[model samples]
Target: MNNISWRGIRAFLYVAEHGGFTAAAEVSGFSKANLSQLVTELEAALSVQLLYRTTRQLRLTEIGQGYYERCKIAMQQLDSAAEWASQSTDELRGEIRMNAVGGPVGEEVLAPLIIEFQRQHPGIRVDLDFSSIHVDLIASHYDLVMRMGELPDSTLIARRLHSVTTRYVASPEFVAENHEIAGPDDLKSLPLIRGSVDTWTLSKGKTRKTVHVAEGIKVTSGRVMRQAALAGLGVTRLADVYVQADLQQGRLTEVLPAWSEETQLTLVCPPLRHQLHRVRVLMEWLKAHFAERYQQALAEGPGQHFKSNLGAS
Candidate 1:
């Protein structure tokens, strides 16, 4: 019956099998009154008396004995199913769909992390999508997504992985041929590779400048933009993480060191997905990986310009 509860069934079975309410209460840690009431509720719901109770003894009726046997088998199966589900949660097994910004950061950084994660958790399969355009995580059925800049969707749960200090960079050859870029205004004089945004914003101390850079080649892909810069195409703005080696190895030159911008890399997921074991594990693993990396960098020296904001959500 609709009003019958599994708890009440369990209670009735305990009293029936143990042969007395007092014995069932002692074995199950349920008080005698509570056990009696539960069995009574079960009987009322079924419209059948299940127990013949007296001061000295409690016994199941003929119909009650038959019902008890059926309930016992069903309860055992239900218990096994519940245990299987609980054990499955302990096992890392599922596919996680993710969307990420396509660039060196995804290729050189995130790709390796995913690979290592797969190696550690061989059961978990990851479906990673790399793109320059922003896609809705919930609508796209993505289990997780990596985003740059501030997230506008307040409905999603997000954690700060790190912030990348951006730089205006050009290939060493391009820098040599072009006029000197002493300030933001000087950037307008040279050829510029436009990225996602048409305008570039830079800040120095308290002064902020927004310049509509002369577009030489416009592309949305950061990987392509980096390639263009590497091939001596033109000046472009890029995250330092993506081009740190290029600057250090003399392949690319930072155009304006004084003026700078930074972008936050956030790990985002739907609130419900964030509660999942696999998704939550991957998220925490990434956060820990970055936190350890940047902390180690900080330990190395003062010149390293990496900041981890793992504390912020």
Candidate 2:
């Protein structure tokens, strides 16, 4: 019809849904004056009243209410049809939604692979969500999450993509200045950069031990903790894969020689229509990148090192 337009229809839907021009204008990225005029023109074209406008408020008339309900369904169908078309290809093409905590995984692991992925399949779009806190994928409408810690209870599928390996870490220079810690107990009375928890559970082979560490300085982010450890602030437990390069190069020393070290980095995906190609492509890309980066970190430090710290603890 003459009144039909993607922008106008979309804007009309937004205003009708929110019951106001200002909010709809915000959603449409249009000035309120412009939106008002557009709606006025739309009603004239349709020869019907869409909204009952007053000085204090606006309410949808019969036509506006009917338009809104149908528009929502139409928009959903439009999005699904677009998704279906995008996923028809075996190649990665479509938007891939992701969320991850800050680390080598986000900066180092996923970042590099995305360039290659876009090059191979130009139609693909990646929206990365990076934050320190865990995200609720379904509630937040995130399609996938690359998580480093325990997965929360949900219907989303989870995949183990990287080993959760942690190790003892301190710079060689720090050790020289602070006096070398011979074992876990030697950390007692040291200026410890404590984590959120007191017990540092370390494992190598069949042995697993949780060392009670007192907090001398406390903040999140292993990268910060590693820097603090290097500055001779105190001992901190770090993911072995994260600090492996330093261990091999004499940059970071493995404080305890015998401790079990293994944890998990998981790939999480929402259950709805998840067999899509973009999800499959990103998952494989992550698995390969993490494997490569993990090996490189293990090779960097002494018996172990940051950057080159390799293998399980």
Candidate 3:
């Protein structure tokens, strides 16, 4: 209806998407009473029952679902229009919500770059979510997500930042004990610091084989895996970037250098969000930053191990 407040529609949309008034309030910074009042106002204007609320759960009615579908589309268009209009202004002033892996990648890598970007573009703000949970870009309303390696099939755009070689490495003490190892098959018999995957695929030229890691120190974080490897816990597979200094200083020894696998770090963007100038700018900024590092690492020569395919499709 013409009298419907834009705020009311936005509040309603947030509640519907978040699946609860409490979640909507948390995300939208609206009080629960405020969200309820707005939704009530919206229902009064439209003269339709959009949501069924009970103590146990809240759900959209059939009519409400249809309305929500259309409203979602309209709101996305409105957001795009607002973004387009803002492009005319000299300063970029908005919030970019990003979902990324936490720990070293979030703190040591991305945090510094984001701080610098914000310094240069004073009007822009970043709301970076460092939750380790799986992310859905559109559903979660995230502007960007940083991910590593084998991405699942999705419609989102993934721009490569860098290609890093995965190395099977262990502490000097561990390597000393298992110095007889020479191939991918040797890894199966040794205790391994493993991630969630049960097997690791290694390639030497065109020859490839999958080694089953049955047991050992299990960890999810790359940083922890590195620590485990350094402690001589077991053999661990790590990206070159994580263990470069360790390899050079003899803290960790790379085993099966001939069987390393390559993985890429990428920034994923929703197609619609990628069209926005702010998101695109951030994407390019990250690409360029990583590109420079990749090049520098490459320039250090073969003795230094950086295999980057930055900006490569």
lDDT for each residue of candidate 1 in 1-313, tens digit (9 for 90 to 100): 7899888998998899899888999999889999989999999999998889888877889999899888876765565445445646778987888998755556556766888899999999999989666777654557799998989999999989988788889998898898888999888777788876888878988899888977589997766787899999899887776566677778789989988687899999876677668888999999989655544442422223222322342
- By lDDT rank, best first, the candidates go 3, 1, 2
Candidate 1 ranges beyond 4 A from true positions: 1-87, 291-313
Instruction: Write model 2 residue lDDT over 92-121, tens digit each, in one string.
Output: 566887788656656655665666677777
- Write the number of the candidate with greater TM-score, choosing between 1 and 3: 3
- The runs of at least 3 residues in candidate 2 whose Cα sits more than 4 Å from the true structure, single-residue gaps closed, are 1-21, 28-82, 85-87, 173-186, 195-215, 297-313
Model 1 shows how many backbone clashes?
0
Residue-wise lDDT of candidate 3 within 1-313, one digit each (tens)? 6889999999999999999999999999999999999999999999999999999999999999998988887787678667776674455778889988665456546765788899988888998889878886655568899987778857889998877778889999998877577888888889999887778888877888998888687888887898899999999997676777788878889888878888778899888788777888888998889656544443442223212323342
Question: Could you tell me how far off, in angstroms, the CA of residue 1 lies in candidate 2 after the best superposition?
Answer: 28
Better of 2 and 3 by TM-score: 3
Indicate the worst ten consecutive residues by lDDT in candidate 1.
Answer: 301-310
Top of the candidates by lDDT: 3
The better candidate by lDDT, 2 or 3, is 3
What number of backbone clashes does candidate 2 have, counting pairs of residues 3 or more apart or in separate chains? 46
**Candidate 1 C-alpha error for residue 33, in Å:** 55
